[model samples]
Target: MSENPYSYVESELPRLLGNSSVSGVYKNKPEDFEVIEVLGFSPEVVEKGQQHWLRIRKVGVNTAAIEKQLSRALKIHPRDIGYSGMKDRMAVTEQWFSVQLPALQSMDWPAWFAEHMHAEVFPGGQVTLLEAVRSHRKLRRGVHKANHFRLRLKAVENADDLTQRVQQLVAGGAVANYFGPQRFGKHGDNVGQAMRMIQGEFQVRDRKLRSILLSSVRSFLFNQYLAQRIQSNLPYVNEGDVLILEGSQSYFTVSADDKDIVERVQSGDVHVSGPMFGEAPSPAKGRPAELEQHVLDQFPALYEGLCAARMGHERRPLWLRISDLALTWPEETVAELSFTLPAGAFATSVLAELGQFTEGEHANSTE
Candidate 1:
């Protein structure tokens, strides 16, 4: 393979690599998880009850499509429907949405939903009459808590045992935080477009339109970098370790060993994450390695994202974890798993692991 072009600026990259110290360690209108809550938030498993938050599954339809359907069905603004994250449409996806039909509480949801739409309702799903403020409250974004899930894929040659491998990282705090290539577009065409626009290469017959598109392109590229970090299992700087931050020129690779700052970085309490998207990839033999360099070259920012799976690393933030997985099958595949997670994690992340992941077909969705 070739060196991933996605990397930090040439002059900015570190000269050599060594073992990093073992460290502890959304979008739309969605707010971020609270600094304290994220580090310590972990909800206990619970049985279904009244007023419980629930997720509804709508297979086949994409997020955009579902949003349109939802808006039309309730005769409400598409904005009125709230979801914490966007589910993919081509594959089956489960999304959390609220509905308030006072008189319909006693009605059968399976029949009612079937009559109104084409998707099937799965178990572990919740349905409750919507509270008045729910309509006005923009569905909170960032997972209130996400349940991390594991899927074991077979068909691996001795060379590649991807299954169980991804799961092993969970114990070591290696999150699948990588921004998939989708964020970069094909060969990073979107990033390239933004580069041209940023360099003033675009014709301005319609300045406003051009600016908006260019901005979106930049954001996508950034998201790509973020995703790469998540996938790599980068370590957060903490306690005895050293770290660098590639901010503006004034603070390039600024290093410090302060425990407080390092811990803050590890917890992601003070600093969230930044994009390594602007950089190019590396010349490497494997997709995973090339991607790692793409992020590592970014350093500190991607640094946290680059930490690999190791023994003894504590999964911080008490992030999402699924235990007691029971796939119920009498009439349908009803997956019952206990979830304990931080306040801002995405439950869909767990669904993504279950396979057949799909986002609803909602055009207004801010995925």
Candidate 2:
């Protein structure tokens, strides 16, 4: 690991298929990037339940602020409001929020929004109610299956080459699933804060902020491990590797003699995983375990702090597969791209592999 574990360039993440030469400007305006949540369950499942779920389209607002507003408007504690995941503040995003209304309390949502849907409610941002339904359960974080993105890239060059790169990515069946810049916070201050906190040089009393900082530390270690694998030209899965099944959180360790694991990896049934350091014993063995240990060895303080904090062990995939990728040229200088990624994956990770963008701020703008 380097002196700054979290300072590596996003483009340095090994491209699974190869690199692309395309260049463009991303998110030139709020309307340029759009995200729609894909709730895996049907609305009818919760129609007769006590929870009221509202699907909202918000522009230039983050999830926390919207949750706060909902709490005040409903005259309930903040904990009474639930959301699946946080959406980006700068993009146009549609997501679901669940409110735990009393069993006997039922109000017309349209009339409710009519009176409370003003600047006073969402002070710095704007939100519109798209749909309202009843659900039996609150929308917990990470409940959504995936997020579909529609983005417009401006001043693009070599449009034909970009198309070829997308094809290669699809055929190769993987893209390096490095935690995007967003995980590290603006200017990557979270990583620095985590290092300080681990060293006892800084203290974060807020549980939420502390959790986020610790996550940044874990993400740094994961990226470092993945970067080394990419640098070594290692295959996605190795003997004795722990592999995560596609579309599931469950994982299993591969035996040294298991030759079919590679086939399973190539067929998109499983993926090679990197560690999210915590208290649990490492599930990996042999070279994979050795590789992970090497990375953690560079950040002893972070490793010790994580152990002391008693965080649970977890694994994240090293590669992400883009689904329903489509490209269209809205103008000679503009390109539109749409794709769907698993809930925890970042859309910017896909863009990083495509090429360098002129407007670099868009790198971490995804929800």
Candidate 3:
């Protein structure tokens, strides 16, 4: 394949605002980068609850480890705990977690955790329980509405130019929704490993790790299709492209000859989506399907492997919109950015467009 799934080239994606050489240091400290998960659903009050939901603010700890700690402290199975999404351990993140606690067996949670699971109890003061409340249901993965980020960039250069570029990006209404490096394991070896598995040269015995590898394979293919779209710079759609309505999973196929479809794409009411390869032929038709097929054809082994594994098809938007994008200069050498993205989107994808930077050690550590 022409594309290298292991490496990301920001230049491959067309920058809505022109490019810049502005450089900065990211995530110098855990507190410098913060994220708050936006849970769209309100917790339904339960008169007698079987589940307890927690809002936790954690630093230097991954979600799984926190779940393990919660399990230990509560004397419950790890599977009994749930979270909406995984948060990066290198940054300060506030998110929700749920525990199944039968009413008859309930303990004084606040007092019990305060004594056994306080910050001092964890090494390096990594995890903290901010609040606990009764919930009628568990917090499930991918249920969050969005993630709000507060990022600090240090030793930034060309501050004025960077601000202009950011404004242009906001005005453009879409950013390339490339999967960040975190999707691929350390140094992006996951893609290679996945390819080996597909070729029958390797086997992944662990179910969770195997799932992650498979996801990496699919994401790599999606990124390839997206990169080609950006590189082509074609009005974001081709004849017989699959188009998805904004904020909805519903989609329909339309040819480029259709005027209404063209208008919808240009007006930002809908987006052109690319294939997440699977067991069957892509739902897209005509030129769009051809483009996708060409990319998949380059990786025959991967395509066959995914089909053999019975991976199902899906589509992701070619672009993402940034909501409430704001930037401030805290110092001549520092810039702070805050914005919200739909759940499953990456903050790094937005940052890549702003400027070049040395990624923090924790940047790719999130699972």
Per-model TM-score versus the true fold: 0.44, 0.93, 0.92
In the predicted model 3, the residue pairs found to clash are none
Q: Higher lDDT: candidate 2 or 3?
A: 2
Ranked by TM-score, the better of candidates 2 and 3 is: 2
* Cα lDDT computed for each candidate against the true fold: 0.35, 0.82, 0.80
Residue range 1-367, candidate 3, lDDT tens digits: 3276545454455554447688887887778789999998767877578788888888877787788888987789977888988888778999999899877666576687678777676676466667777867877888889999999999998888788878876786577888887787766677788888888897889888888988888888888887777666656667788888877888888854687776788777888888889987788987678779888887778778778888998888877778889999978899999999989888888887777866666554574
The digit string of per-residue lDDT tens for model 1 on 280-340 reads 3222223433543464454433222222211111111212233333222122222222333
RMSD of each candidate? 13.5, 2.3, 2.5
Q: Which has the better lDDT: candidate 1, or candidate 2?
A: 2
Write the residue-wise lDDT of candidate 2 on 271-353 in tens digits.
Answer: 88989999898899888898889888887788888898898889998888788988888799888889999898988888887
Best model number under TM-score = 2
* Error of model 1, residue 294, in angstroms: 13
What's the residue-level lDDT of 9 in candidate 2?
Answer: 59
